[model samples]
Target: MKVYDVEGFPNPARVRIALAEKGATDKVEFIPVDVMGGEHRTDAFKAKNPDAVVPCLELDDGSHISQCTAITEYIDGTFDGPLLTGKTPQERARISMMNLRAESGLLNAVGDYFHHATPGLGPDLETDQCAEWGNKRKDVATRTMAYLDSVLDENDFLAGDTFSMADITAFAGLAFADFAQIDIPANLTNLSAWRAKVSARPSVSG
Candidate 1:
């Protein structure tokens, strides 16, 4: 399999985490996409995935897989090992729900901050309302982080005791926020503690 990857990005990092978890990191080819250089917007890249997103998993069978969750699910299903998804249908549903929960809270927050406050990606910065929206986005992101921290206080993993795709998504998504100047404040003690555990895992690096 060939993986179109990009560092310093949330979605791609989730794939990387899944690969690391599966001990399949070296099994696939990694092609780095320079997002800052607009490589993802090129016709060549778009031909692979019209969405022009990073972490495109091109299978050996000439198949392409987009979306971090879908890619991870495919890997967990096709490969034989400890499944990142749940064992039962109800468990799978719960895990999916948790993953979406993190998306609305953690992912949206970082996006609101990055696409609005950061340069090189904002569409237009000339409007006052845009500034107001940016501020609001930052607020949502911060509060979401806090809310997730509380939710995490009761469990080891996002979905349950065993590690699931939701945990992978949450860990990588939160890592992105940490890189974007959004410090994990002291109020989120559970999150800080959980982060320490996740970061210690070998997958967090590769």
Candidate 2:
């Protein structure tokens, strides 16, 4: 299998962390994509992933998978590791719910703030921006942080007691929040402590 992505980017980092947790990091070839140069928008690259995004997965059978959630699902199913998705229907539904909340409410929100409100990747790549919408999304990110903090107050992880893909998504979201200069509120102590604990995991610390 192969993964096309730029290292250190938020979405890509989520997949990388999932692979590391699965002990499958060494099993796949990593192909670096020149996203900053607009290579991802080219016809050739878009053929593999219509979304024109990074961290796309190419299977051994010549099929391709796009989007972090889909790629992580593939990884969790194929690799032998702790269940990152879930084992039961209830667990799966809960993890999926939390994962979506983290992706849309936090990660994507921070991304909008970075690309639209700020200079982002420069005028060349960020051709269109809406500061008003971006600022609004920034507020959404903050509120999601508080929501996750409250969730953490009741459980060790976002979905429940076990470490899962929801935790991975939220962790990467917070990392992006830092890069975008979006402050995690000082009063979100549960969120802060949860971040500290997740950071210590071998999957993230490495």
Candidate 3:
């Protein structure tokens, strides 16, 4: 498999982390797609993924898979290792719920603030920015931190006691938030501890 992504980007980082958890990082070839240089907007890349997003997986047979969650599902299912996606139906539903929550409330919120409020990528890429809407999304992202803190207070992980995809999404979201200069409130101690534990994993550090 060929993995196309830009290093340090949030969505790509999520897929990389998933691949690491699946023990399949060494099995695939990493191809750099220069989003900063508008390489993703090229005809070649658009053919592979019509949406023109990175972290796309190209199979040996020439099939392409995009979207972070779909790519993660493929990785977890095809590889033999620790399962990031849940094994049971109930676990899958719970993980999916929390994962979507993290995606929308944290990750997407930061992305909106970055693209709409700040000079994201550049003027060429970030058109139609509205500071008012961007500020609203920033506020949403901040409130999400508190909600996640409460969730973490009850359980060790986002979905439950075990480390799962939801936790991975939250981790990636927080990393994006940090990059966007959004600070996590200091009062959220449970969320802080959970982050510390997840960050210590070799998947993130290595």
Q: How many residue pairs clash per model?
A: 0, 0, 0
TM-score ranking from best candidate downward: 2, 3, 1
The candidate that wins on TM-score is 2
Candidate number with the higher lDDT (2 or 3): 2
For candidate 3, the 10 contiguous residues with the lowest summed lDDT are 119-128
Q: Which stretches of candidate 3 lie over 4 Å from their true place?
A: none
- Each prediction's Cα RMSD? 2.7, 0.5, 0.8
> lDDT tens string, model 2, 21-128?
999999999999999999999999999999999989999999999999999999999999898999999999999999999999999999999999999999889999
- Please give the lDDT score at residue 160 for candidate 2: 96
lDDT of 3 at 124: 84
Tens digit of per-residue lDDT, candidate 1, span 9-111: 8888888888878888888899998876778889999988988888899999988989888899988887766788889998899899988877767776676
TM-score of each: 0.90, 0.99, 0.98
- Give lDDT: candidate 2, residue 184: 92
lDDT of 2: 0.97
Best by lDDT: 2
What would the per-residue lDDT of candidate 3 be over residues 94-183, giving only the tens digit for each residue? 999999999999999999999998997789888789988888999999999999999998998999888988888899999989989999
User: How well does candidate 2 score on lDDT at residue 196?
Assistant: 98
